[model samples]
Target: MGYRFHPRSRTIKMDDWIFSPVLQRTYASTEAHYLLLRHLFEGQPIAYCRVSATCNSLNVKARQYHEQMGYKYEGTFRKDNIARWGTPRDSACSSMLDDEWPLNKSVLLTYLLATNFDADGKQIRSLQELRTLQTRCSL
Candidate 1:
């Protein structure tokens, strides 16, 4: 679901993280991705993590999801690859720096807590809502 690279450098590149369509909106993907990040960054020397997604209709939601997870968009790599259909596809790149990880980690942890959900399993507050509130409080 996720990966860590660059043992010598304080950086990791996450590649090929995908979840089945049935798992969407269930928080499985988000939790798994966060766990990978927590494992790599907790008490480790990692400082940056980069992730990229293909620029296509299918991946538009993925890019937005990455942003929701606190990744900052760097730019797009034009014609980064040729799809299996022989169509040129761009890649959107994003990264999360060490300085920004702590807050993100906190937000994720808070969001994942049982108290954040209701009896019906609906979220008491959305991730963005928590992030916004935490960011404002930290200032």
Candidate 2:
């Protein structure tokens, strides 16, 4: 994960997210990302947190992951960056505001609980599903 902070705006931009193939299907990446968000929102004076994923098939999962974590989609930034191979890349942007963090944090904590997984380490409910349920409960 990459983080850039703007003091004046009290915003943090998170990019360059990666998860090793070996750790796929495990919740390690999810836990780490949530921890980072928790720290930023709870420990720092941040008002907003933005995350971006390169818009491509290879990043579909990454985009979904961010959405599952309750980041609201902003939009795509077309040709905003050049790839390592020099190709123009579009990026999908999303963000979570300070007021929105509490709900997301609750959902994350509930999903990360040991009881949420079984002996086989499979989640009883997905993060997205839990988020939906939590949202409904709040309403």
Candidate 3:
């Protein structure tokens, strides 16, 4: 998911991803997030980027996923918008800065390019797993 923010802002918004249940756990959205950030940072002067999710258990997972991708929690806006049933929903915001891109890009590439998946396509090392290993090695 990629967005073209207004010229006044140097930020890009990461949009949502939807896929069939069978395609879940494939890390497709993770790959797309990496590709979008890479393209934006490499092609233009993007100093910041953000992704938002609704206040729900699923969105909490989404937030965690964004964090694993190197975004920092920026704070949430309670009752940000009304949902389908007219219930107010909160928005969880997370962001990444230009200076933080290199490490994230390298980490994501390592996961995407790894050949450790088993016959059923389950990953041998999850993103968080690889990130921990990367952090340990860096230290």
Q: Per-residue lDDT for 1-139 in model 2, tens only?
A: 5566776766777775777898765788779878888877777454444333334424788778778878887888888767779998888888888888889999999999999999998999898889999999999
Against the hidden reference, what TM-scores do the models get? 0.83, 0.88, 0.78
Please provide, for model 1 over 52-124, each residue's C-alpha lDDT reduced to its tens digit, 9 standing for 90 to 100. 3334434778788878888778877787667669998877777887678889899999989999889987889
Candidate 2: pairs in clash: none
Best by lDDT: 2
Listed per model in order, the count of residue pairs whose N, CA or C atoms clash below 3 Å is 0, 0, 0
Q: Pick out the ten consecutive residues of candidate 3 with the lowest summed lDDT.
A: 49-58
Predicted candidate 3 versus true structure: per-residue lDDT over 2-114, tens digit per residue = 34474456565544444467755667767876887787666555444443323332376677766787878787777765665998777676777777777778788888874
- Candidate 2: list runs displaced more than 4 Å: 45-58
Clashes of 1: 0
Evaluate all candidate structures by whole-model CA lDDT and list the values in order.
0.72, 0.77, 0.67
* TM-score order of candidates, top first: 2, 1, 3
* Greater-TM-score candidate between 1 and 3: 1
Q: Give the distance in Å from residue 30's predicted Cα in candidate 2 to where it truly belongs.
A: 1.1
* Residue 5 lDDT (model 2): 73
